[model samples]
Target: MKYTHTMPFGAAVHDNGVRFTFWAPDTALIALERNGLAAAPMTRDADGWHRLDVPDARAGDRYQFRLPDGHLVPDPASRSNPDDVHAASEVVDPQAYDWKDAEWRGRPWTEAVIYELHIGTFTPEGTFVAAQRRLADLVALGITVIEILPVADFPGARGWGYDGVLLFAPTAPYGTPDELKALVDAAHGLGLMVLMDVVYNHFGPEGNYLHAGSPSFFNAAHQTPWGSAINYDGDSSRTVRDFFVHNALYWVEEFRCDGLRMDAVHAIRDDSSPDIVEEICAALRDGPGRERQIHIVLENDANGAHYLERGADGRPLTATAQWNDDLHHAAHVLVTGDTDGYYADYADDPVAQFGLALAQGFVYQGQASVFRDGEHRGEKSDQLPLAAFVSFLQTHDQVGNRAFGDRIDALADPAPLRAAYACLLLSPHAPMLFMGEEYAASTPFLYFCDFGPELAAAVSDGRRAEFGKFAAFGDEAARARIPDPNAASTFEASKLKWEEREQSPHREFMAHIAQLLAIRHRALVPRLAGQPRGGRHWRDGEALRVEWPLANGATLQLLAHFGTQKASGIRQLAGQAIYTDGITTDLNDTLSMAPGSVCITLQEDNTHG
Candidate 1:
């Protein structure tokens, strides 16, 4: 089957010829330059858009726009940039690739066990084809969804995709657009849903030519950490908003992606009634979402829960769910006892907060955050479904943002970390794993990027300097020990050593996780839809208790003791034991949960009988 999203922007290939659409509202003069050949003058309409109808132009042709200043710039809406961001844009026929997963309707959000990965660091080849070859491995690990880091074309040979500058085109460093499509097709055939990460908050520091053509794309009044926030609500912002809305659609329809996970949405500054996020979700729900399950998750640090509100029909009003940073933060504090930056917010009694997260979604829930200087954070999330929050022990931000990018395995004891893993995966919340987490790989997921010499040095120096507040990196010599992000070795060090899975400790951990996922798929997954909201979580000191009512009139119970010693006076839980880790015993009608242990049981509601 064939799929194509018809957007007003970008080059559209017709049977007769190609029709080019360029939106440079501020520019008066422009022309189309194809294949480094003679330039063809374009006609500018009243809205500052230029159009060029070329009868001979066809797919696979390279093109760029010539500004009035005599400078050439690639199209912002390019489908594929084979050469790189600074080079020519390739005209791609989205309908050319024949999709084999035409019948892939997609799995429900309740079934999501997200496995987030960076394409460049996921496999040795760091290409789409290599990643495709590893799809069955993820499926074998029981990952229902694969969330890819942003693939939008960015400058340089290697980097985390968050720095992507091109909003539409897939990076050339990965395979061609067709190869990417094949990967998505292969994933769907394996019952895996692929989700792309998109950044609409701010463009990268390099290779953004919109200012040279469409100067109004950035709003000067609102600033972000990356720079000026995107012009989402200012004057001439309709076209800017359309650019991103169509981007979401293009990925789902043209690329046949299952959905998107918008990066750092809290950084986006949009003041309109129906915000950009809402508009994007509405577009999807009205468009392709009507047919298949197309999810829109978010990485909003602000902890906004309103966006995850469901309609009267129990369908998501806007976003499907958001990354539950609160859960990760609490788990980190509880396991590693690391109180730095945002982790400081969860330092005091993190076990209670962790329980709240497992039972009631986000723990903050409109509470004052100490790390935010007494500022209130998050909305009430107790009423939301457990699956509305994507839970994880680690993410790109959780690990990569660190000074050394140490995984949780390197931070805490093996027993506590094992218990934490059980807490994360066995919970009703949608769980996600950073690449290679299932195997307990020893590699660190460091922050690495390749930029020009000037920007590269600045980024490297700034990266080392940012950890100055930490006592470990207070000295200049100590700070210098941090790996340089621009170094090729740094990027190579972040790649997963796939063969490590056959080793002793790694193989043992992999088997444990596989067993947990097997039980989850057999017991929890089929009954997830019955859970309308989060469960009840309470804790007495380090001993935590959580319970959820499932569809079969069974109460799923979890008893965990995070203390260094055994905890007594625990009420005995009745039901079939689903899984157990560590030493848990029952004596004289009382339960004694050993230190760093977790127990899962199901109590069927058959007392009346």
Candidate 2:
């Protein structure tokens, strides 16, 4: 089987020829420049689209567009740009590659144990082919989904891929477009689903020539952290909205991606009804989702509970789930005790906050956030199912954006981190791990990027300045110790030392995780299909308690102690103890929870039996 996502714009190959189309409403004259053929003038329509037809164009042919002023730019919807984002685009026949996993419809959202990874650093080779070799390991580790960082072509040799300019093209440094498809196909063949991370919030500051060609692509009325906001609801914004919506479809349909995890959607300021996000989700739901379980997850800081609404059948109406920052922030405070920045909100009572997250999804449901200057954040999330929130101890942003780029294992005690991991994987919520979290790999996921000299120094200096807010980096000398973002060593230092996984603590952690996942699949996942909601939670001294009602009339309870001192009066509840990690009970049936220990019990409804 072969797949190709035909788009309205860009180079589309047909029997007649390759029809090269460009959206340049601002420019009046346009030309197509190929390797062998002379620059041919393109006919412009009233809507600002330029079109040209070449009968001899074939796959692997390099072509670029020439503006009225003779400036050349790569296609915005390019499928592959071998040279880079700034160079010519290679005409790709997506159907050229035979897809192996045609029968892979995708796993249900409830079965998701997402492992978010960066293609550039997932393996030693940092290419699609190299990353494909590691899928069997993840499958053995019980990961259902592999969420890769943005592969859309961004400028420079190294990047996080969030600043991508060409939204449709796969980055050249990571290998060819067919190689990416192969990676996805290999993952599906291994019974694992692949999810691509897409950024619609803002294009990278550099190598984006949309403003030069399509000046109306942005709205000046609204400003974002990264310049003007994308023109989703403004005048001439229809095409802009279509561009992103099509990009989402392209990944799922053409690349055969299981789903897409949209990055920082809160930054996408749109005022239209059924806004850009809704439109994209609707398109996915009606498009590829009609045949398969194509999921859409969001990293929305806005805490938009409405977007996570489920239908009568308990499937998502729009987004499948959201990255639960509330859960991470609460757990981070309990683990690291660093109550600075946004962690300050959870610092007051992290255990309670963590309990709230476990029971009700969001802790700050319409409550005043001290970190946000007394502003009320989040909506009522008690009604949402536990699976609607994707919980994790570490993510790329949580780890990489830190001053030292320390993993949870590095900052907190092994016992606490282990307890957190148990809580993360054992719960009803979907759990995600950073690339190396399974084995607790030793390398730091530092924020590294390669920009031109003009922006390189400013970016390096700004990275240092951002850390100045922390008390540890009080002085310039301390701040200077922070790695340079643009340095080659910084990117190299961030790669996972795979050899360390076979070492002492890492191997133990990996075994522990595998055990937890085994229990989760055996005990919990079977109960998730009936729609389980987060239950009640309360604090008993230093012990945090939470109970969730499962779909099969089972009450799943968790008793965890995060304090340095041992927590007493953790009553041994009337249930079958499924998992006990460093938790003990006295002879008198009085329970004692050691610091950084967890105990999980399940009470089946015997009343009906």
RMSD of 1: 1.5
Predicted candidate 1 versus true structure: per-residue lDDT over 1-609, tens digit per residue: 999999999899999899999998898888999988888899999998899999999999999999988889999999998878898999999889999997999999989999999999999999999999999999998999999999999998888888888888999998899999999999999999999999988889899998788979988888888777889999899999999999999999999898999998888899998999999999998899989999999988888999999877778999999999889989989888899888899888888888888998888888898999999998898888788899999888789998888988889877778888888888888999999889888999999998999999999999888898889988999998899999999999999999999998899999999988988998888777856777898875557889877655667899888898887767766788888866445666666777888888877677523
| lDDT computed for candidate 1 | 0.89
Candidate 2 vs. true structure, TM-score: 0.98
Error of 1 at 470 (Å): 1.0
Error of 2 at 305 (Å): 0.3
lDDT values for all models = 0.89, 0.89
User: Tens digits of per-residue lDDT for model 2 on 292-341?
Assistant: 98988899887989999888878888898999999999999888888989
Q: What is the lDDT of residue 562 in candidate 1?
A: 89
